[model samples]
Target chain A: MEWLLEANTAGHKFALMAIAILLFAVVMGGILFAVDRPKRVPTWVVVAGFLGPTLLLLVVGLVYPALSTIRGSFYDKTGDEFIGLDNYARIFTDDGFQRVLLNTALWVVLVPLVTTALGLVYAYLVDRTRFESLAKALVFLPMAISMVGAGVIWRFVYEFRPDQPGVNQIGLLNQLLVLVGIEPQQFLLTAPANTLYLIVVMIWIQAGFAMTVLSAAIKAIPDDVVEAARLDGVGGFQMFRYVTVPSIRPALVVVLTTIAIVTLKVFDVVRTMTGGNFGTSVVANEFYTQAFRQFNFGLGAALAVLLFVLVVPIIAYNVRQLRLSEEIR
Target chain B: MTTTTPVMAPVPGEADTRGRVHSRAERAQKRLTSRTASVAAIVIAVLWTVPTFGLLLTSFRPELDIRRSGWWSMFTDPQFTVDNYNQVLYGGGTDFATLFVNSLVITLPSVVIPITLALLAAYAFAWIPFKGRSVLFVAVFALQIVPLQVTLIPLLSLYVDSGLAGSFWTVWLSHSMFALPLAIFLLHNFMREIPPSLVEAARMDGAGHVKIFFQVLLPLLTPAIAAFGVFQFLWVWNDLLVSLTFASSPDTVPLTVRLADMVGSRGSDWYLLAAGAFVAMVVPLIVFVALQRFFVRGLLAGSVKG
Candidate 1:
């Protein structure tokens, strides 16, 4: 508040504001450029329409900031120095950043696998059930809530003050633990377990997605094949394994890879719950930490780039899976 | 453990013995699914629902009670209260109604700008023979995966630089950019499905491109419009990141961000938080339910490739 008020008085913010508008206008203009077809709008007019807005926006809003972030990553914390590879080196060697990386690894791997598996099973079970709509809707309700909303809801579910006298636990898990004649621990503050707690949020949000995609796939499992399986006396579990799973394999890949890609970008829950404290840091959290909290723009940009890099493979796989499915059709 | 025996059973015509085993295995499978499968489905449905149920209950409980006890405790004690509802709806100075008015002010324009731009861009991509259309569509689609958070800092910086960070135009523009890719992809698939002959007929009738799109195409795209509108509404409404980063001015922030502050200040105020969360969720839920009927049949209308 103080700085903003002072900055306003000095009129520095105005210049920055103009630059922002110009950036958007240029980007929109660039989009117009690409959009221009010579016959309809006249090539020059089309080019001006597209390039004028898109380039302005991209340069000032997106491209410049991205480049600035990359540049900042090469510089020191205050965005002044020029140190190459040092920030990247710190990410690999530093204990705090390493833990963040590991937590992210566990999250990216486990959440997607579990959520997808859960969705697959749910999809199969509810495929043609009497209550399929109701069941799927229940699972997907969380999807409509922001990640932040889910995080706040789960925070209470995992909330803990120390198990001291008169604290009275609010976290449901801890409350249950106390009932079983065991000690209640600060679940969010606990080392490795906290990561599990955070991962559950992703699973909750994504399982519905998995279920929706996989259920649709399950429904699309050519009725004839299912009938053939029935004639072969492959009922129940066998039918699912041989007939259904194989049929939905492409959709399964899409769901799994989508979840993996989303997992790479997990942020809100960590930020909301523990604020990236304890040992539950992930790449997104680390990116924020380095960039915003610690003001280490260089390391932060490195983390963001690493996230982008790590995500490309899964994204490619997902796109590949989609293209393959399109081709098969 | 049981898999190897059945799969490795003798060829079907080998012996009656093998036949009996096969029939037994088949019967076993039937029994396994009918009896046991129901149990697994129920368990998963129940497990998946717990946290949401917790949120539902927390919304109804009194503020003090929420801070004092686990949300699950409502089952045992079953204390019915509207205190939270009261506090959330009409209690404080900046009540839910006021914040919701703010949310609406922000949400309406945000939804309109993207849909308008996306529809034009999507039409151009789908029909108006353009250069690099596929690449452009692909690029747009790819941007959908960029973490909104990653965009936030730069977006905020850009907004700050332009002096529009706190304005409705700033948030609306930000939302439009973020939403363009998905909207274009979905709408393009739909527009392509419109049968090129219809477009060609309009073109032959001396209809301009914009006229054909709005007068001819738009009406036919009701289901698509409704579907995308519902999604966009839900997305913008539920969105916290952008609403927080770009639209946090006193006049502009939406319910999701306001809900966060309520949680921060009134951490112990369950009544406020629950009511607020519920309020934020209500419109999206309504949108889904109303449009949900059109949802499945809308885009996934045709037999899409599995």
Candidate 2:
């Protein structure tokens, strides 16, 4: 039991893991065995065997903690004293916090629009072309990489070295700048633009997701509708505008809203690339920093709640759109 | 195939040939549109690929070579070694080998437990005549929208109070709890699509709910299970926030948390960072590339249903 709580070595850790899995298996197996007697067992007993763990976990894990966090947001830093709305006030009034909000605003606005636009255009281009799957896979590969990996990858690309004799540029972007006879700049150190730079990593990772969904949506457009548009002389960009865009409007909305929600919660890239320095922090990263790093529990909880508040409308609108689309179906 | 076709011979009652000619014309138009689109697509592909390619190539380059030159310089002066990988994996200070194992240990249970729990719950929601089934199901589904951030503070406190703050148990339990809503919703959707007759038929044969679940449903649910399994596998493997918050001790911290810490502490040590990034990424990339079909299905289902 003590070793289960504290595994100090590799052997101990693996042993603990095995024990945990076996325990889960035994519990679940016992439940099934107890309930496998058909009419001998009551329906409520059967239901409890299946649903009890999940329901109990949800109530204890998600529901209670979420309520506690919301409550914690109103208290003082140590979370013992009730300091009504001070954390929220500081979040709204503090200049640094405002930058976080502004950066979050930028992320919520730009990442989705740019990523969706890139994805939609890319999906449209390779919709039926030769080498389409391979090309799309190339764009979609980034989605598979963790954001921390992406952050490291981009950090390498943005690595800075001062310009001097015999000290060549190490970062590709800087080298490109040097090749074109321009001084290399600190891409991650500069304000405002640095946030955009961090946002690029996100867009890079998410474009694949956007493209996959939108490409499927484009394929789902009825061939008859396309043929009708072609018969009506809609060609080239006009076909894209009037026929393609309108046809996949539902998917486009879904892609945009999904990416926006994901972007709102993005933490790793900023945390990895800059550690939320240079005014690059969004609400998610700020929440982590406040809670864990600075031990400002109340402010962190407030930021977390702020994130929850921000996500609701987007999700609500997404559900509404999905419902509308389903109703149409 | 196109070269063998006659271009302008519209013979009588040869609708097939006419269709071929029409398609050829469409292909011609498509070729025209594809020209510009191809260029844009190529540019995007290059932009998306080069950063990752640069880091991967650098991971093979010697540490000094990496520090001194861009990876693109490899074309003119190709210097490579496996030392960076060696150092990152087994080097005394930056050993990723332990973290890699930690990632595997944390991820497998995290993925398996939630899917199993969600599977049973989804089965109940789909088949069992339980009171408040719809209400409870919707409540679980709605829990998906409650950001994991909201649960972090008090959950951490809960773990601290439970004497499990810095163990693998904390990470695994947190991940499984967070994954349930979406897993149950996704699995329930999958279960509902299993014709009700299948379960009813099993019941008529004197099979219990558990028997129907195992003998009838589990086989059909494999693909759904695989979809969510791959998804959760990749997610838990790549996660940083949960592992960082719960697994405060070195013994329990997974690769993402360690990798993120490396990026913070050794920001300039591209030698270590490059190899470490790959160490963290390789498992998910393999899972993703191998089970891409299931992964895409899961993604589409999540996006559409949500």
Two-chain complex of model 2, DockQ on C-alpha atoms against the true structure: 0.50
lDDT value, candidate 1, whole model:
0.69
> What local lDDT score does residue B185 receive in model 1, on the 0 to 100 scale?
70
The most accurate candidate by TM-score is 2
**Which portions of model 1 miss their true places by more than 4 Å?**
A1-61, A161-170, A323-329, B1-29, B67-78, B89-94, B261-268, B294-306
How good is model 2 by TM-score?
0.95
TM-score of each: 0.84, 0.95
Model 2 CA deviation exceeding 4 Å by range: B1-32
Please provide, for model 2 over B238-304, each residue's C-alpha lDDT reduced to its tens digit, 9 standing for 90 to 100. Answer: 8889988998587888888888888888989999999999988999998888888888888888786
Model 1 chain A: weakest 10-residue lDDT segment is A1-10
**What is the per-residue lDDT of model 2 for residues A69-140, given as tens digits with 9 covering 90 to 100?**
999999989999999999999999999999999999999999999999999999888777666777877898
B1-306: candidate 1 lDDT, tens digit per residue: 110001222233432444435557655666677667779888888877887677788888766777677777788988878777777777755477766766766676667656666676667777666666577667666665555545555666667886766766677677767776677678777888898999899889877555676678889888787778777887788777667667777656678887766655665555666677778778777777666655544324322331
Evaluate model 2: give its lDDT: 0.88
